[model samples]
Each structure stands twice: as C-alpha cells, then as structure tokens.
Target: MSVRIATDGSATTVTASPRTLTVCVVITTEERAEPSWVPQLEDCSPALRRALERVGLQAGELWLHLLGIGLERGAPTAAELVDAVAELAPAELRRHLVGVHVPAWRALVGADTLEAAARGDRNADAVLLADECYYGGRARDSLSLLLPLSVAQTKKRVADVLRRFHNEVFAAREDELVAQLERDVDAKRARSLSPDALITAATRGYVYEPEPELGRVVLVPHLAARPWILLCQHRTTRLICYAAEPESAPHAQEVRARALKLGRALGDEKRVLVLARLAAGEAGLAELAESAGLAKSTVHHHLVLLRDAGLVGMRGNDQGYRYFLRAEGATESSGVLGDLLAPR
Candidate 1:
C-alpha cells in the first residue's frame, strides 16, 4: 500500500497503510522569542526535513498548519500553550498527533506538554515549547531516556496504520505479518544491548600514557597551551600525533602563508585563519575573530565550515561551547591536511 506524508508549519504527519503518525515539531513561535532561549530551530529544521526526505515525502503531499499565538509572556505555561494547539489542530488529526516541545526553561515542561497532548482535554493540542531543556541538566538526561520510549510508540502507531491500510486498500493479508517482522527486528536490536556488558567494556580501557618517542610534539594538557595541528583518519577514527616545534618556526610560517593563500583562493580568508588558530588551542570566539580580523558572526560562520571539514572540534560546558583542534594522533588523517598538521 502507498503512504502519504504531510505537514503544516507546526506539525508533521507520516501515513502508511494501516496506521497514520502525526508529530508536532513546533508548538508555538512566540515562545521562541524568550530572552533565555537559544535558537536550535536551524538544527532541528534540517533534521526534520531530512527525516521526511528519507521517507520520500514531498511538500505537496504534506499539510501545513500554523498556530497563531502571540509572544507576550516571558514563557508560556504548559497549560496555556496546550490550549492554543488544541484549538488550531483539526479534530481528526488530534487523535493521531504526538507533540514534541523544546522546553525553554524546564525540560519537565516538555514531558508535561507530551502528557497534556495525549489527554487532549484543553483547547490546544499541547504546545511543545523550545527551551534549554537539553543542555547539561537533569532535564536533558531525562529527555534522553524518553527518546527510546517515544520511538517505540511512534513505530507501533505506524505499523498499525500500515496494517489497516493494507487490508482495506491492498487486499493483502500478509500486511500484519510484515508489520510483525519489522517489530521483531526492532526488538532484537534493542535487546542486543546488555547493561552489564556495556559497563564491563567501558571499565576495560587502559590509563592514558604518552608515547614521547612517537613524535616531537609534547601534549602537556596545560590550560594555556596554544593550538596544535591534528591529523584525523576518517575511516579508522584515529588521530596521528605531531608537535609544532620552536625549530619548525620557518616551516610553520610557510604553512601559515600557504594557508592564507589557500584562503584567499577559496574566497574565505577568515575561515582559514580560524582553522589555523583552532589547530593551535582552545580560543574564545571573540579572540579567534580578533586574531583573524573578522567579525564574531563571520568567525562563527568560518568555524562552522572548519567543523564540518573535521579540522575542528567543539565541546559544551556549563558556560558555553568551546572550540578546539582535535588532539594530534587521535584521528586518522593519513594523506590529507588533517594528517599534515598532526605531530609526527
């Protein structure tokens, strides 16, 4: 049987034969404007678009529904937000819909919103508010645990829709059998993870020790160390170590000159400089911008490119995200510049 996927701006739907699955990607735009909120819609939007694309659904096959809510409150309460969604969503869509809210302040608010959506006692379909719920907090941890549960429920819904569609439209009795097989496969994958085995594997790693004879570069792990070049192997995921020595000053200067020339050739001098700086150590975005002589936004844009190229890495702490060069000899860069920068 054929399947249909549809979306309004706020919600998305995927329908296969016996089941229809409705997902609310965004609950309201007003909550998005909160002072405490950080915009992740850029990342989320791409992920949702990709998921729909993978399932072969185009814009025409999806419906778009917009929730017309104004942004006045610092952050809307779960109840207020839910009322708005229920009012806007069609009654037929309500029964099949699953809301995904990005809570702005408390992740528990997201969980609360999900429960509210399932009950549908309010005027709205349960608003999923965008908030700082997925950062390094208890809510973030809780949300991670909830992900698998949500996936399981959604899978079941889709299977049910497919089974019904096949029987009614395709006149196929094997539809249920096919659905069961899919469920079995999913179950098998889930059961393969044993907690005791995972714990044992994690505890079996050796202590960190340096191999000085491996290269001229010394990794002190000092907070003030300058950025060093790292070479990463893409396939094996190993880093090749290399130290930039004081004696290598002339070569380093030449490499910098070459980098500048390459940057100019690519019409992106700032990016090249940013990559060079990150290869040296963890620098603030502002510092990187100043060193590269570019605006902060421009520096960020360049960093994104460097990050996508696997020349840079980022880790988020409580304060914010810190950018650094991947450690030398940790990744496999073999013949590429990723390797050229590593300690040898």
Candidate 2:
C-alpha cells in the first residue's frame, strides 16, 4: 500500500514524525455542529431560541455567517468574537459566510454573484440553482433569507444575533466549554501521533484523506456537537469538530458496541464487495462504484459504514481520495468479536 505525505515539507515521513501533517487543533465559540442549524430546538437555550426567532436567524445561519470568527488566529473570548462580527466588512462577512470554494460552483456563480445577490439581483437565483449542491430546500431557504438583504443589513443582523446569543446563551458555559475543548486538544496533542493517526483517533476511525488542494486540517472539539463529527470547508483548510470520547460507558458496553458495529458493517454483501475491492488496491469512489456495479452515492454509503467500522483507510492526491483496507482494523474486528464472546 502507498502512503501519501504532506508535500509541503511539513514532515519527511509519516512514520518518522508525529506531526506528519499540518493539523491544527482549534477552539472557538463559532465552532458549532455544521449546517449549524440542524440541532434539535430543545437543545437550544430559551434565550438562544428567542433570539433566533426575533431575528429570523436560524441557529445555523448565525454561525454559518459568522464562522470566520473561529478562523482568526488567537482564540478570542465569546464577547470578543461577537464584537468582531460587528466590525467585519460587508463583503468580507459574506465571503466568510459562504465559503463555498468549489471550482464548479465558482465557475457557475461568477465573482460578483454574492454582491449581486446582496444587491437583490434577480439573476442570482438562477445562478445559484445551477449547482446541484444548492438544489436543496434548505439552500433555497438560506438564499431567500440572505439574498433579500443588502450585505450591510445581513452584517447587522448577524452581529445583533451573535451579541444576544453570547450574552444570553453561551456566556454562562463559555469558560467551562473552552476548558473541556482545550483539555481534549492538549490530551490529543500529548499522544504525539502522526496526523493520519491523530485524525482517526480523534474522530473515532473516520479518516480525512487530504487532497492536493488542502493545505491544512483543523480539528476543533465542540461540546454541543456530541455524538457527531462536523466538517466545514474553507479555501485551503478543512475544519473538523468531533465529540470527545465518552467516558461514561462501562468498559464492557464499549467493547460490545464496537463488536456489534463491526458485525453489522461486515454483515452486508455489497459492503463486503467494496472491502474486497479495497483489499486488492486503493481505489476512488468512481472505481468502487464501477466494481460494485452500484451508483456512486450507494457506494459512498457503504464506504461510510466501512470507515466508521475502522475497516478502511483513505489517501488523497490531486483528483480526490482513494480508499484502502486498513489491515489493523480488519484484524482487530475478529478479536473484538472474540472478546465479546469470551468468558466475562
């Protein structure tokens, strides 16, 4: 199997250096579970909920538009972050909010589309609809809300919502949350694993194969994102927020969970076929799709299950990620099952 290292002299060899990849552990109030809007309403504080309604800002919208606050260096307090929002240039705010740096999307939407949309240009809707990624009702709703407002108006609304959110919702828990997130970051750094291993461990076996276009990976630990890993994309950086490993479960329960998950992942015939293909060599999504004679999306689903079960690893080049079997995980699956079946 071939291993790909970061080409920018970040590390000489993956095995030789713990920091083989340029991975940064970031902590910020702006790091919400992605799409930032989908968490259950009951999960939100009454103050936050009211603020959302007051401004017609979905919880996700406020964060989606303000996440640039997290991208800045030197973690700022929640109050400072809220204040930073008020100071961003209208164009800068929009750019940061809509960090959709996809080549095709950019080609279709053009350089001036965001400002045009802010200016209430009618053609902006048509341009946005051209991309399949924006076909969703959610995207339409977000566009509706955003496109109607001038950029300056959008900035004011975002700043106001964030200020209220900081004062009412996050301020109380900010220190405690920051402490927990920092502790996770420090503890993970203490492990001194290579970037590949660090990401896999922090994300509980989910490997982020960095493509040629990606220069950096930022891992942020978020308390509100428990039981889920969140991904956000910037021009050259990918931010991943993962839940800290739960300590509350009994050891046996944890083992049983792992064993059962492996069983379920290996139980599927199509997934097994995908694994078989990976065993021969690392392959991209299209190749796996063709080998399995399934749609790309179907193959992608199988990949997710296999990856979650720790049965697969991936590497990236200029084109995209190539999936390979992780021999360690495949070998460990049997031992996991054996432990569950063995005498307690």
Candidate 3:
C-alpha cells in the first residue's frame, strides 16, 4: 500500500500539471462477437504467443522462471505456446535458442526519459514505442536480466510476427483496432489520473516502482507481470506501460516464500554447484559432495535446506539417498528471484 519506489524531487502531491494519457487495456469483443467499441487486445495476445513460439521452449521455461505462477496462471499461452520449440528443433536450430528472461533487453521507458522528465522535459517519442511485453523497465538491470536468445533471433521473430500480422490479422482488423484505440484515447481525455494512481497502477510484483517525469503518460494495460516501462534510451523517450494486472493479495505469501527459498539455496557456492549437478540428473549425496568438494556433512546440510526449499527432492534407494531437482520448484523459485532483483 505504501509507495516502494520514489524519485528525487518527485511530485509528492497529485497536482495537475500535465503528462497523462490512457489507452484501452484492450480486448477483442470476442473471436466472433459483433464488433464492439472495445479497444481489442487480441493482437497483444497473439503477438506474445508468436514471440514465445518463435523463441521456443527455452522461452517457456524462461518466462516461467522469471514470472513464476503469474505467467503460468495469468498468461498461460505465452509459455505453453512454445513448449516444444526447442525439442522439435534441429540441433543447429536448437542451438539458436538464446533464452527468455525477466526485466527485458531495455526499458520501454529508458533512463533517459526518467531524467528528462525529472527536469520537466518530457519526450514524446519515448511514449510512442511501448514494447508489447511492458512489465520491464529498469534499464540498469539489463545485464542481469539477460536472455539466452541472440539479438538476431529476437529481431527476426518480431519482424516475422509483424509481417504476419500485417498480411493477415492487421489487414482485416486494423479498422476495428484503430477505432477502438482512438475512442479509448478520447474517453481517457475526459478523466484525470493522480500521480499516486499512476505510480500504483504502473508497478507490479517487484519492489522498485518507476516514477518517470513526463507530461503525457500513456498506460497500455497488459496481462503480463510488470508494466513495460519504455524509457527514451534511444530515439524519443516514450513513457508507455504495457501493464499486467497486479498480483492478487492472496498470492503474495507464495511469492515471498519462493523468493526466500531461492535466497537460502543460492547463498553458498557449494549449494549452487549442487544445484548445477542436479540439473543434469539425480545424484547421490556422496557424488554431490565429491563433485562440489565439500564434506559429506556439509553437502547433506545443503541438501536438507535445498530439499526444504523444494529446490531438490531426495529418495532413498539400495545405494543410499539420491537427490534431484524439482524442476518446477526450481523455476518458480528462480522466477521469484528475478522479481526480487527488479529495479526499485
């Protein structure tokens, strides 16, 4: 409920100065419903699906790893759509699987926009180029949020989706889409949004909330975890947010639990090695200890913690106890870790 992110000299008071815009969160009336005035988000859904499908399974795991149950429960298609991309791919093609990631390559709203806006200089271009996956904005955290996919691959997929949309969907749906967008714009103009409302709505799972200084803030509702903050890192700064719904209050405990588990499991180098080993297959405690070059007791202790965190599950056999990672748990834990690391 409290403001977790703050910028120096940010407007503490919700005074009407300038900088506010609202576009439809967007949704198609339905696949076959009569065209209505609703600003359709049909494109956003497919765009995400296509992007993930283009990227493949690595994309699926990555999205889940970063977003946890949020992506699994909310934007299910995103990860599920690409579940087989890597498996069905040729070795060379599969090798091209870079990776999916949290945050994103760059903030839709770059640091440039944040600084400029703070100076009372809003950039129009920054608000124009909002990315479809809008829940990412911390420009400084780019390196840590790295994906496995190459630049070329991402670009190619984006281009291909756009091309397909241009030829098929957009051609048939442009009028509807644009009409709804324009209508939403007009409707938003009739209402005013306070700064507090803007910040609260803009933020998602992470602690860091971005308070960009802009005269014209455009909120594009999305179904992703974070609101994509496209800053003006390049051209003109566009303060646009492809916002996903905030996590329900009930789910907060789960997020915190996952984060804590990942934290405890990741704190030691030996445990990390244990996790890496388990990634390949199950290993007995002796093997894990030898490989990690830690004492048996030490390794056992690590395993205990990992097991409790649900990072690893162990079984007893004729030889002794063997441990293997709970892949889903690991992913969910890691995803929470990403959320924890997001820029404040």
Candidate 4:
C-alpha cells in the first residue's frame, strides 16, 4: 500500500511507496522586499533534501519537481509554476499530488492566488501552508488587520506588560517577546468583551471575510499532514492546537472517547473542537470527521473532552474564540510521534 503525506500551505502532494517518493516544492518569489530573484531556491533545495532524509526518503529515490513563480521581474508567474508542476509530475502520481505554500510568501501575495494556481490539479492529495518554523528561532507572523484605535491602544498597554513578563521568563529576543506580547494582548482582549461579541467580531474579521479569508487560508498549511496543528488568530488573541484526524477505526474510537469525555465536561462544541484540533495538530477536525461523515457539531463534541482535560485550550477573540494546542512538558509520546502525532 502507498502512503500519502500532505503538508499545510503546500500545493504538492507527496506519495511514499516501497519503490519511490516524489516531492514537489512550489515556490513563488517576489521582488517587492528584496529584488527579483529566487530567495530560498538554494537554501530550500538542501533543506528539502535534509527534510526528506530525516523522513527516511533519499534524494536519488525521490523525484523533485520544482515550480518557481517569479513575481514582478518578468519572472515566472503563479500560473507558470502550476504549469511546470503539472508538466513535471508523473501522470499517476500527479493524481495524488500534494501542494505546499510557504506562509511567509503566502501572507505577502494572498492565499487565493496560491489556491487558484493549484485548482487545475484535480487530484491533489493534500495542501500544506506554513506560517512559522516549527523548530522556533523566529516565528512567522500571519497577516492580521490593524486593530481599531481603541483596541490598538489597549493592546499596546497589555503588550508592554507582557514584554516585561516575557523578558524575565525567556530572554531579549524580540521574536520571543512578540509571542508573549500577543498572548497577553489576547488574554486581555478576551476578558474585556462578552463571549458573544467576541465570537461575532472574530468570525467577521478572521473567519468569514472574503478578501483575506485568514481563517481558511491559515488552515491550509496544516492540511497536508496527519495531525494538524492550527495556530489561529481571534482578534487580538492567538490560539494553537492539534487538529486530530480519526479516519481509521482505532483512531476514531480513541478520538471519540477522548472527545466525549471532554465534551461532557466543557459543554461547548466550538471550544472542544478548537482544543481537540490543537491536540491533533496537522490532522484537525475536518479531516478526522471525513470518514465519520459527522456534522461539525457532532465532531465538536469530541473536541470538548480534550479541552476539559486541559490538554487543549481556547483564547478569546474580539469576535469568536481561537483554539490553541497547549504545549506542556515533553513526553515520550511527543518524541515518538515525530511530525504527525506530536503535541502542539
């Protein structure tokens, strides 16, 4: 049997078999910040090789399809990259092709453009979109609208407090400080509003909006893998969590049991789903419920169990709650799961 590995924020699907595994890295480069050129081509080539090696896939045994989109310098367009991938991909494997988009670039151009490029590939297996580096030197920031004046000032005040707190806890890295600031800002924002108002605002700004479609696009990066970890923004707050998949019988039972326990305790489907999804990072609820054909509500019930278990959490947004995967102390299972089953 062949195993399909899809990643978040990507347009290419990778299939691993006894004989071979193919990887298609779709890169769209622009000249806005730095001039017209491929920034990561040289870096990414070796990184891809190393990533594949770590995953037990060798360079020679794999087919590397590089789709480069040159933006603004008479370079390759998004369409060109798609066409190149289509042309290079083996017909049979193309049917199982996976798509990945680097989040840093995706945020600059917009996900719709990337999604449109992949639309022609009908049989794509999974799409991987990335927002930040998992290993954590500098965490990438997803796009967010500037807050209204009132909210912005309030956030600033909270951020100042958090900056100091994080400095004491972590260090002088601005990146880490910013993360702490975001968390504090979110906490304060949640406490300032009612749950209903928070939900409505968050849904409008991040979830349902058409222009950016931040919620959906943010989710794209996590779709390519087994356990999906979604780090979602809700207004001033941010959340991280595992979006578990329960496609198989054993997994489904485990998910249901865990979900039931948490659901009964929490009594909130949205909260539960957010937490459970965080726990199952890279394989969130939508994928898990794919086989069960359950309504979002039914699937959400399972999510609540983990929320109550304190294994998952939700942060308040100006509109709705943003879910997060709580990363507690390290465990053996955390190490064993590697990328797919690791806790957020």
Candidate 5:
C-alpha cells in the first residue's frame, strides 16, 4: 500500500529534481473491491440495514466466512448464500472458504499445523475446514467453527454477489470514470514536464511513500468512500483505487492564477502589438519601442512585467532582454483553458 519515486521525470531529459510525488497507479475492480466494501465502509448503517431486508440469503461462504464475527443488521441468510456457491469446484472453493471465525482460522492456515496455534487450555488453537470435515466429528466447535456451506457453494455465491454489485453500481459509470482519470493523468504530465515540477494531488485514503524508481500515477474508481483512495504496489505499477466521487478541478488554484495573469497580460492593445513584434524576431528595448509606437520606458516597463511573469527571457547576448513565451508557463497555461472550458 506504499509507493516511492526518488527521481523526477525521465533521466534522458530533465534529469533529477525534487520528488514530490513518486509512483502512482489507478486501477478498477468490482471483485477486488468487495473484500473492503460492506465491512469497512464508514456509513455501513444503510448497507447493513439494506442487507437485512434485501440480501435475503446470507449463507454464502465468502460473505459468511469473510464477514463473520458479529451479524448485527445486514447479514443475508445462510441457506440462500450456500445455494449460490453450490456449483463451484469443491477443491478450489475449499481453498478460500473457512469458518465464521476467520482470524483464528487464518492463523491456523499460516501455522505449520493446527497444534501450532495451541494455547494453555486448548490442544489446538485453530482448525482448517474442508467439506463435511469440520462440521462432523473431526473438527467443529472443538477446534474451529462449521463452515456455512461447502467450497462449491461459497464460490458460486461470491461470483453472484460480485456480478450483482458491478452491474448495479460500476458498469454504467466505467467510461466516465476512466475519462476523468485520463484528464488527471494529462494534468500530471503537464506538470511533470515543467522545470520546477511538482505533483499536487489530494486524497484521503492514500499517502506518499518513498521508492527509488517512481512509476506513473493512475486512478482507480470504486464504490469507495469519498476522497479515500487506497494505494498498493502491483509489480511495477503503483495502483490507486479510490471510492468514487465526481470530478473536481485539478490543481484549481494554479489554473486560476495562470489564467488571470495571462488574460490581463493579453488584454491591452499596446501589449498585443509588442507581442506581435517579438514573435517575428528578438528585439531590444529600442526596437520593441519603435514597433509599438510607445516610449522606450513604457515598453521597457511592460517587458519587465513579462519577464517577471515568465513570458519573456534574456537572450544569449545577456545585455538584451527578449520577450518570448516560456515553455514551462505555456505548459501550465494550456491546462487552464482545458479546465475552464470544460463542462460546468
């Protein structure tokens, strides 16, 4: 759940700069997301309540074993859930299915033997359940609890729940979700290419991690909570899966300042003429003054502002200042129009 990028941009071009944001990746998944969805949700009251009413069959092994412990409100019935998983392969289903007490059961899995988890009073602290096994004389209430259904039942139930959640919530919104992420990637790229590059993204679910080789940041949309984005490492990819929310402006303040400055700078008749003259070729103070029909001092004053704003630069001669747009500033400026002109 952490990523690192010690260097900035490509080594071939800009070389090293400060590493503000290292590696980021965005991925989408209905299946992977289910593990954390109903259980850990901040506002579980609604879903829990709904589960009690609408989720009639809570008997599936995936839901029962994983969401086990205390069933307060939204637990589906055991029979309905077990029936859902009845078609899966027994061996494969057995692999993931477990008793209601998963923590104790998982501990049993990691240990060399069930006896490995033995405590003072109990000879065995946990037990692994496999078809008609734990529920019968071999295990059950002795070392472990009964699995709600067989492996086949758990598998089918899991698939049904996953398919249902996807179609109901995520499928219709997939394209729009991906499109928003693409805009974010484009915006980050624009900043990454700048001279003093920095990435400024806000998320509640994730934080910056340190790594030597930083990969690209991507967006993963989920039926997750707002602003909460989960960051995890996937081989070379740094995946950021977040609870879905509507798209907000990217780096909104930077876009506004850039737009305002550039707008005012171009709003004058005299300044426009000076820009036109400069575009043709480099010009000194006197040359630009003559072309604009303005006094040398007035033109000089404008040139000073342009330079300060990063729209003008000093020539190779050093003595002469030439008015030219900075690539860095333009890169940022381009995104402003894209943001403002975007749908309200």
Candidate 6:
C-alpha cells in the first residue's frame, strides 16, 4: 500500500536559491518500499515486520520522515539518527512521530493541547481530530494508536521498534547503502540543476511547487522509497524523501525481471482500460475507476500494479491524488523485453 501524506501547499510555482536548498540521503530498510514497487522485500526481518504491524504502523515511510528530520538536525549517520530519536524527550518524540503525518501540527494543535491529549484528555483529542492534518485515513489511525497511550509509553514503543529495525535490517548493509546514496547525491549536485528541475529529478518526476511559507527544500535520497516519494513539511521547510538511483547497471536477470513486471501490469483488460483513460490525461482515483467501470478499490489495485511496473506516477493536490502515465516507461517496455530475450 502507498503511504500518502497530505500537505497544505497547493499546486503553485516556487523558486529557491542555492543558499536555501539542501540535498542529502538517509538510511532505511527495503521494507519501506511500497507494495506495488517491490511486491516482496525478501530480506525484511519477520520479527521487525511483526513489531511494526503490532503497533499499527504499516506505512514504512513514516520512519523515513523521522530519518529526514534527523538528517536536517545534523544527524548524518544512521547510528547518530537513532541516537537523535533516542535523545528526544518523550513528549517531543511523540510530536515528531505523530506530526510527521499532519503538517504544521504544533501550530495548529498548540503544545498545551498536545500535552493534554497525551494525558488522555478527550477534549484535546477531539481538537486534534478536528484539525485538517488528522483527516487522512492513515493519519487518523496513526493518531488513534498513540492518543490512547501516555506520551512516554509511545516513546518507548517507537524507540524500541526503530532500534531493532536498524540493527536487524539496515546495519549490515549500511556502508554499501550509504555509498550508493552518496553517489546519487553527488551526481545530482554536479548537475547544478535549477530548483524546480532538481526537485523533479530528485522525486523522479514530481514537480514540487513550494508554498509561499516554505523557504528551504531538502531532498533526502532513500533506497526503500523506490517508485514513490515521501513528503513532510515542517513550517518553512519541506523534506522530500526520494527514491535512490541505482549506481550499478542492471544485470541480465534484473532486465528480465523488469520485463516480467511490465508484462504483468499490462496483462489485464481492466488495467488496460485504466491505462487508456490515463493516457488521455491525469485523473483522480474516482475518475479512473469510473472510466474502467470498476470499484475504486479494484481500480486502486490495478493502479498499484501499474505504478510498480513504472508505468504510472501521481501528484497530490488539494483535491486528492491525480495520476498520470509515465510515457517513458510505457514506450520502453518493448525494448526492455527485447533486450531480455535477444540472443546472447
């Protein structure tokens, strides 16, 4: 499932000078990958997975937001980042984890109310529920899970899960992962792209038009977030966790695997109809579902497959998610398959 975090910014043009922009990368597990993208992350630890599910934390990109916050605070290394979270006061840790879902949560909810909610004040909880930030289905669940617990209790559970995940899932390949991300960051830096272009490239085609209140945009490359970008806004700063670019050439097996993925995406009649509708222009989930003559849930399933195959991309707006075809992926499938089957 995709983890879509809402933002207050509308679709508008925003420009930033080099002094206001920062680019970096953070460490996370392949478990962060969307279901559509990887289907299965074989190395993901079963125990760690169980821990996440137990806490009702299905969206792995939530950790990416935590990592991005740490990166912004000068916790460059994974170990340092884990420490950063560990060091935060229990109340502050609760805010960071919950606020990652809701934009401008502090200003909107106020510190006192948040504290009250942590203390099991129903009125304070209602205030948070009424706020627009907590409106998303997942955001609602995130808040619900933590609201019942004391802030300190939430902190203990969150810290335990993060530390265990880092040690069991990310620590072994830390060097290799960091080196790959560094190469991508360096390559992007060398290009000297304009702010808009850099954002689009970093997000793999998401053209972010920062809001007027925003000043700094930090792009954090994440390997687990492939084919999907995670966005978090902290007042004036926007943290974009983008899919990391692979440093190595695709192996023969890799090429074939991609071809098979594309084939699966194109295999169904309803999905083909959905693609045809998207080919004409961008459409929201409802519109595509209508065009495909299927339930929104069924249409969403097809969209996920299309997304995983790299044939579709989406942009969020005030209205909701609007999806479009990735022309490059659609047009290159034949060549990908040909390369896979060509005589060696």
lDDT of 5 by residue, 1-66 (tens): 112343445331121111111111112222331222223222334543343223233232223222
Of 2 and 3, the candidate ranking higher by TM-score: 2
Per-model CA lDDT versus the true structure: 0.33, 0.59, 0.40, 0.30, 0.40, 0.62
Question: Each candidate: how many clashes?
Answer: 58, 2, 30, 64, 21, 0
- The global Cα lDDT (0 to 1) of model 6 is 0.62
TM-score for each of the candidates: 0.28, 0.66, 0.28, 0.21, 0.31, 0.73
> How much does each candidate deviate from the true structure in C-alpha RMSD?
20.2, 7.3, 18.8, 22.0, 22.1, 6.9
Writing each residue's lDDT as its tens digit, candidate 2 over 1-344 gives: 11335655753222111111111211224434223222354566686565455445433422533443545633456676666667778767766554344332344456577446545566875566345454222344444455556778767766666776566556676666566566666677778577778777887666666655556666766655454455554556565666664443687887887876687678889999999898898898989999999988688778866776778866553335678888788678878878788886
Better of 1 and 5 by lDDT: 5
Q: C-alpha displacement of 160 in model 1, angstroms?
A: 27
**Whose TM-score is greatest here?**
6
Model 6 residue 90 lDDT score: 84
Is candidate 1 or 4 superior in lDDT?
1
Model 5 TM-score, all chains together = 0.31
Candidate 4 lDDT score relative to the true structure: 0.30
**Residue 156, model 1: Cα distance from true site in angstroms:** 30
Model 5 off-target regions past 4 Å? 1-148, 193-207, 210-223, 231-238, 243-245, 249-344
List the candidates ranked by lDDT, beginning with the highest: 6, 2, 3, 5, 1, 4
Tens digits of per-residue lDDT for model 4, 167-279:
33222333432333344334334444433333323222222222232222111111111122333332221222222222225654555444444335456555444445455
Candidate 2 has its poorest 10 consecutive residues by lDDT at 16-25
lDDT of 1 by residue, 1-344 (tens): 21122323322111111111111121122233112111232333454434433322322111111111211121132234334434443432222233232122123344555555444433222132223332212222222222223333433333333233223322342344334323422332344333222211111111112122211111111000012222211111112111111122466564554354334423566676776776678887778989998877677667654543345665532234567775531242333344347685
Q: Which ten residues in a row have the lowest lDDT in candidate 5?
A: 16-25
Q: List the residue pairs that clash in candidate 2.
A: 36-60, 37-60
* lDDT string, candidate 6, 213-273, tens digits: 6555667676654555666665466667676765555589678667877888899999999
Q: Could you tell me the TM-score of candidate 6? A: 0.73
Error of 4 at 104 (Å): 10
